[model samples]
Target: MQRQPIAEAVREDIVNGKELVFVDFDHTLLACNSSELFIAACKPSWLVACIDLVVRRLIPWKLTHVPHWYRLRDYACCALIVLLCPWNVMLWKRGAPDLFRRHESRELAVSLRACDPTRLVIVSFGLQWIIRALLSESSWRDTPLVATPNLAGPAYFSSGKLDIVRAHYPDEVIARAACISDSLDDQDILHAVGKGVLIEPQGDVYRAEEHLYLPLRYTAAAKYARSYVLDQFLFVDVLIVIAATSFGFSTLWQACLFVPPLMLSLMCVYELGYFENDMVAARKEVAPTLTAKVERYRTYPIGFGAWAWALVLGLLGVLLGWHFGALRSETLLVSAACWLAVLAVVRAVFFAYNGTATRWRAFFYPVLQLLKYGSPFVLILASLPGAVLVLSQIMLMWCSYLIYRAGGNNKAFNRDVLRLMMFGLGGVCLAASFRSAPVEGFFPYAITAAWACARVFKAPIMRACKTLRSRPARRSETAL
Candidate 1:
């Protein structure tokens, strides 16, 4: 039976000659899926445990063969509803008001309220009872809704929804109507309507605009580029190159002249490795776990532009090095050949690492890190002290990686372990200085010790001072 206000509104809309507007309920009017929320609210302990087991244990094995686990999960939830219809209905009725208030998209709700109530209709694949119960206490109580009739029946989704709309209104009405939805599944209905408005998810908010249905690759190019370039910063590599040059050359002018081009070349190599690794991961279907940022990264398409840019930067670095006397005529050919060989080896290792499955990928990570950190040594082959410094730094980093992995990969724990390792390396370098050139050895010790102490103790000292300050405030409050 049609409510009086909805019937009256429809009659008035027809009289006023306004076209009907259709909006999807889930992820459009609401910020979350209503069916998932219903299942979460009403599922018993046994059902919850079963679902958890399937997700954690069974799903992983099936992921390689069946990527559509979400559809299966939805079917399971619908099956539960059919199995325990009476209990679910009771639970939903009791919880509907609170759930609706918490999950309704306030911005969309406001926009929807501004529309002529008679011309606006809510359409969804969600069960009718659930939708009605959620909207019972809202201002939209009388809004006409076309939804799945029951859990056991076929969902009024996709073409079925179009058929139902056609039955309810004349052909002329649908031809002039507009649809708002977040799903591509509603493309048929969107085409049937005169206009389509898409609700695109951007971080925490949804942006609604005219639907152009752009391809994922084109829409997400900027996001993918940002992820590739900014995800892991290259400052540590910069510092390594600077430290190497300072230890290698006695004259400050020589160090200054050579470091810039060497650093540029190293950066180009790192960027090339990153680009190839990401491309291989994409082809092998080894995507990162689902998150908003990672999802954007996954959409990055293979392109020649990034490859061309990396090659250009590398060539520029080589030219600058030759012009600046870093690659003198006497040794230019040998040095360039060695550098090319090193580049080839690094690229091969990256391909191997990227092609490996996730289960065994960790084993390759340390090797990859070692090659990257050690590659700068090829440019500073003449300095024994610089070579020693670089070797010690690599050892410290490698030990830290081992400790980090052994400790279940907790980031805070890894940081503390790295600091302790740095302190030890500093002490070793300081003692070794007595046997070698004091200035060369002392430089590394000074850098490592100062950095380690500052990072490791800064947090504790600040916390102690904060506690002391808070005690005085608490004492004053007690006296009052």
Candidate 2:
């Protein structure tokens, strides 16, 4: 016998007084996109995947928002999906179950449990096969699914969803239905429905109970103050200060007295810069859709309280600096003047860095890094060897950041290479330290080398131990 149509079946269920509820799958029910998860699960080369992500996912996604570009974007997305279908099919079958369990939106999942099974329907612009594979053993497995069927044509999206749903149900049925989605693209269907539930990000998880209306305004209160404070705790800057003081001053007691207040003032100023940078980023946001606007609002929520706290902290830093003889002409005046000048220049560079175009940001980043690493030099009257040691450390840090950003297919290989580089830098510092003063040069180099080794090896050693512990459990499971 032939199977009944999906819309006909769904309409039959809705006829029994249960209002139809159409829920989006990706980003609404799950914390991430299903297609991206599938790509990751395929275990392709990292570089290839990164490139694919930018070209296929990011570019097409951005293009979809441009006027009159929807068709082109859809065609491009569909073509890329078709090209990757074979690989996706081969991998998703094995990985879907695990991916579903790991990435399901817990808050949404809880809310969904209270939803009437008969009234609920899973609708997605993602591949039907992939979604089906993911939900094979899930609670929603038997629920009606309205998804893009095959590589037949462009995926149903925006108003297309409304048209597809209308094919299944009459105008009256649609008039009384509800749509739960994260994207503003679903606004057409949402307006047609009786109720609209919007999914929103709350810290680490997603919540979807908020009633969605067009022209969504910024409403979330400042919740990221603690996060901002934590971000400003620049321990590396403190280390640089300590290294400079130890080498420049006659006694270690001077470092003890000077480092704290100096660091406080520096961190406070840096945090103000961070706030400015955040504001700049917020201003540059292109949020055409209500959903995009809401997300962007949440990301850069108005937080004058944070600004106030930063100012207070900065005042406290200044007070502490004054109390610690930071204002004293003999101990801190010349150094402070020099440090202030450097700080002024760096802060100006930071402003320029924020204002510069995206392509030019890379050029400014290294200069900012140098300011961060080399500013401590003003605290000390440094010899050539001591300066070389500091410069060497700065280069090491800059190179490490670049390596991390330029991720490759083999992460382990990249990590090993970074470790070797760290060791080599440490050895160079150790040799240079022998030629300089004992207290200033030797001690700073020793501390720098030790810190580098500790930081580099800590994560890998922890991972190795974790793997070793897990091996026994895996072996036992295999035997069973």
Segments in model 1 whose C-alpha atoms lie over 4 Å from true places: 1-235, 248-291, 299-306, 323-337, 357-363, 381-389, 403-407, 414-480
Counting only residues 3 or more apart in sequence or on different chains, how many pairs clash (N, Cα, C under 3 Å) in candidate 1?
0
Clashing pairs in model 1, backbone N/Cα/C closer than 3 A: none
Off by over 4 Å in 2: 1-235, 247-261, 271-344, 380-390, 400-441, 464-480
lDDT of 1: 0.56
Q: How high is the CA lDDT of each candidate model? A: 0.56, 0.55
In terms of lDDT, model 2 sits at 0.55
Candidate 1 C-alpha lDDT tens digits along 64-170: 44343443445555555547555867878888978788878776676566667888789877777888889888887899998766543322322455777786888
Q: Lowest summed-lDDT stretch of 10 residues in model 1?
A: 206-215
For model 2, how does the per-residue alpha-carbon lDDT over 301-354 read when each residue is reduced to its tens digit? 223333333334334434444455443334434544555675567668877877
True lDDT of residue 50, candidate 2: 38
